[model samples]
Target: ASRCAKVRSSDVAVLELERPGSNARHRISEEIARAISEDKAEAIVLGCAGMADLAHSLSEEHGVPVLDGVVCAVTLAESLFKVGLKTSKIGGYAAPRGKRFAGMFAPLSPAG
Candidate 1:
């Protein structure tokens, strides 16, 4: 509860599910219904990747937008690729300088 409280704000309410799993569809729906009626949440975002399959049905059931992180991530990646936007390779994600690859990975070594 403390963690949820720490992340909660006036605009965002973080509600935890009692039973978090793909099989807990009924529980998840009930929790989302509570958030809608009580907290007045306009959209629902599933917290677990395992819940991705339920987003569409839940949205239809609750008459609100439901988002899955996996789908959102893939969609975002597609949009970024279409726009020619890519992750910068100069900072934390930069390949190691002067690194040598041997064995089956020899061809993957970055050019100096």
Candidate 2:
């Protein structure tokens, strides 16, 4: 939440839930309800990739858009692909210029 506050102006709320527990749907629904009523949240974004499956049903129940990060990422990637957008090879996504690989990774070292 603190990190988010530094980057974004909107309020950030963290709701922790058990990763493999059976009651996630219930707890998430309760949190969504609370966020809407208390925080005036217009939409909810699922924090965990594992929660992707619950977004649709939760949105239906809460009457708001519930977004899954994984889905959003894939959709953005697909849209970029469709529009022939490619990552710039001269910048951050560029091939390493002088990176070295040692031991079992020697074959991965860039060639001269």
Candidate 3:
């Protein structure tokens, strides 16, 4: 559970709330909504792996995308074996190149 991991001296802040059932769509949605509202998570993650199908609706209410465990597992797998990460380094990351630009966006920076 996220809360358990968070308290494990890992410096990870987490909150976990369990739902009554996964097969029951409405129940799961309610549980997730409650958690999102109460937990105030920086980014909400779906507790149930089976809720991948309702990501859009959840995001709409919470204003953030919900992540599923299955996708995470596969991503961890690929990163561990270096099968795709090293082969295609650009796929996972990129830096914003430096360039001069004149625009109102300059005031967006905190220092500006």
lDDT for model 3: 0.54
Against the hidden reference, what TM-scores do the models get? 0.59, 0.62, 0.44
Cα lDDT over the full model 2: 0.74
| Span of 10 residues, lowest total lDDT, candidate 3 | 4-13
Give the clashing residue pairs of candidate 3, or none. Answer: none
**Candidates by lDDT, descending order:** 2, 1, 3
Candidate-wise lDDT, in order = 0.73, 0.74, 0.54
Better model by TM-score: candidate 1 vs candidate 3? 1
Candidate 1 versus the native: TM-score? 0.59
lDDT of 1 at 74: 95
For candidate 3, the per-residue lDDT at 20 reads 44
lDDT of 2 by residue, 1-112 (tens): 6322121112222333334445657877888888788777777877777677889999999999989999999999999999999889987888877977889989988854
Best by TM-score: 2
Q: Residue by residue across 20-103, what tens digits does model 3's lDDT show?
A: 433355555565566556665545565555556666777776676666767778888878788544444364566445555458
lDDT, model 2, position 99: 71
Q: Which stretches of candidate 2 lie over 4 Å from their true place?
A: 1-21, 90-112
Q: Model 1, residue 21: what's the lDDT? A: 50
lDDT of 1 at 7: 21
